[model samples]
Target: MEFFTEYGEASQYQIEEIIGRGSFGVVAAAVDTQTGERVAIKKIHDMFEHASDGTRILWEIKLLRLLRHPNIVEIKHILLPPARREFRDIYVVFELMESDLQKVMQVNENLTAGHHRYFLYQLLHALKYIHAANVFHRDLKPSNILVNSNCKLKICDFGLARASRDDPPLAIFWTDYVATRWYRAPELCGSFFFKYTPAIDIWSIGCIFAEVLTRKPLFPGTNVKHQLDLITDVLGTPSHETLSQIRNEKARRYLTGMKRKHPIPFPSMFCNADPQAVRLLERLLAFDPKDRPTAEERL
Candidate 1:
């Protein structure tokens, strides 16, 4: 990080405290020397199996460059070592955000009005803007969302992000980095389709929404098979066409084994769910990704 030492801002940054940590890297709070501004410094985990880990770094750059929404997190710049070392990687500089939705939900007693709807609306706005840019944020859980100075929501963590810009209008390809198990979408449960699309991100948004309402994860399944069971158990088995898209034969067999068209109809989990909220959840938890609503269409 010596290269960053002369960047001036980082040197003056007091390293107030450890903000958070994830598989990708450690987040630290720092003060800027040039302007006395507070910023969040995300130090990327450099010890990747190969050099390909830079893909997400590139994604953060591309996504930030294109998206300029009030709700989305703004990236200051990407920090590199001007000089290199064996394990040295890069860091992304962003204007500091004070709180994340997850923490706010826990601490605030009156979280229903300004805190809730404001963040939700901005989140949806950001979602729509990026989706229009053909960028799919594969991960949308609470920890990834940060609250800025004006109490606006800023989305972060582009590690699992993918783009629809690949040419010939290609499908939103699937990746294993579907955030956490609880936030995982139903369509991803049994598929390995190379053409997985942005619809999966919608399913994740639904999960996050439900989690915010209940202050707990909606489908906190233990494993992949269990995750599939939970999703199938909720939305019912997907159609043959949906099953056909998945390349994994095991996924096909699993779908074929379900004799009932709507195996999930019975045994309602949220029996007391409000009609409006239930409808939203249904749209989100749909077995077929095609059936799920786009992030923009939430309104």
Candidate 2:
């Protein structure tokens, strides 16, 4: 297919095959003719179809431009349609990655402790940069993390991310459902008024780290209630003090009325994991967001 650089330079990229298709758009494997570099191009359709969609597209572009880190996906260039005013497609080109962490985990059953540590370290390294920019990746999961044969990992997909202020205002509800249910933080399960924080991403990282070790989701809940139940079952029921911190009355009451449970020790849960790794996991998975360590602290 024909493509052009932002500076109006004519370039040719042969689409090899369709790589992925999601709600946002289609991604395809391609090769740049001039450089012979393998690349992945995401063609976002109807980016300006609705006001909200246009806003989201712009937000993602802005964040990607600002975020520069080794562990984060790099945007090579943006290819707009020839006619800018009537453009219907937005193509974003990125360095091609061999696969995502989810697929890697599915096939690699003999992952070592060092592999787990390295993956978590790379993830936190990326988070350190993202959070340093006052940005929160609302969606963090194995699928969103790209991995190569060399075992290098990079964080991708910032469509759900938002700028977070140092002192975030309360009741600024962007979306009740932000993250994938399995990796979602407890506060996000049913709490409508919970403010955004980088700690939310830490909760997801904890879930991912657990999955890396066990080769399964830490909390595989079928729905919102079940998700919360799975989390509390392992972490134990939230204390009265923790409940008080929840801004959603309905969620707080639901958690409070649940049968009290003592936390299952991390070592028992991750039987073969490194003791220090388990300790860090516990801190990352704290019920209270305030108790969760920052990305820099985790690193």
Instruction: Give the best candidate by TM-score.
Output: 2
Tens digits of per-residue lDDT, candidate 1, 1-299, equal: 44244343345555767788876667888877767788888877663555556776766778777778777788876664545544365667788888887887677655554455566677778888878877788888888898754677788877677777566456545567567778877656665576777777788878877766667776789998778776776667777787777788887787778656455542265554455665666776677777888766775
Estimate the TM-score for candidate 2: 0.93
Relative to the true structure, how large is the alpha-carbon lDDT of every model?
A: 0.71, 0.86
Worst 10 residues of 2 by lDDT: 1-10
Worst 10 residues of 1 by lDDT: 1-10
Clashes of each: 2, 0
TM-score of 1: 0.83
Clashing pairs in 2: none
Q: After superposition, how far is residue 281 of candidate 2 from its true place, in Å?
A: 0.8
Assess every candidate by TM-score. Answer: 0.83, 0.93
What is residue 97's positional error in candidate 1, in angstroms? Answer: 1.4
Model 2, residue 44: C-alpha shift (Å): 0.9
After superposition, which runs of candidate 1 have C-alpha atoms over 4 Å from their true positions? Answer: 1-9, 45-49, 80-87, 113-115, 148-151, 166-174, 192-194, 259-274
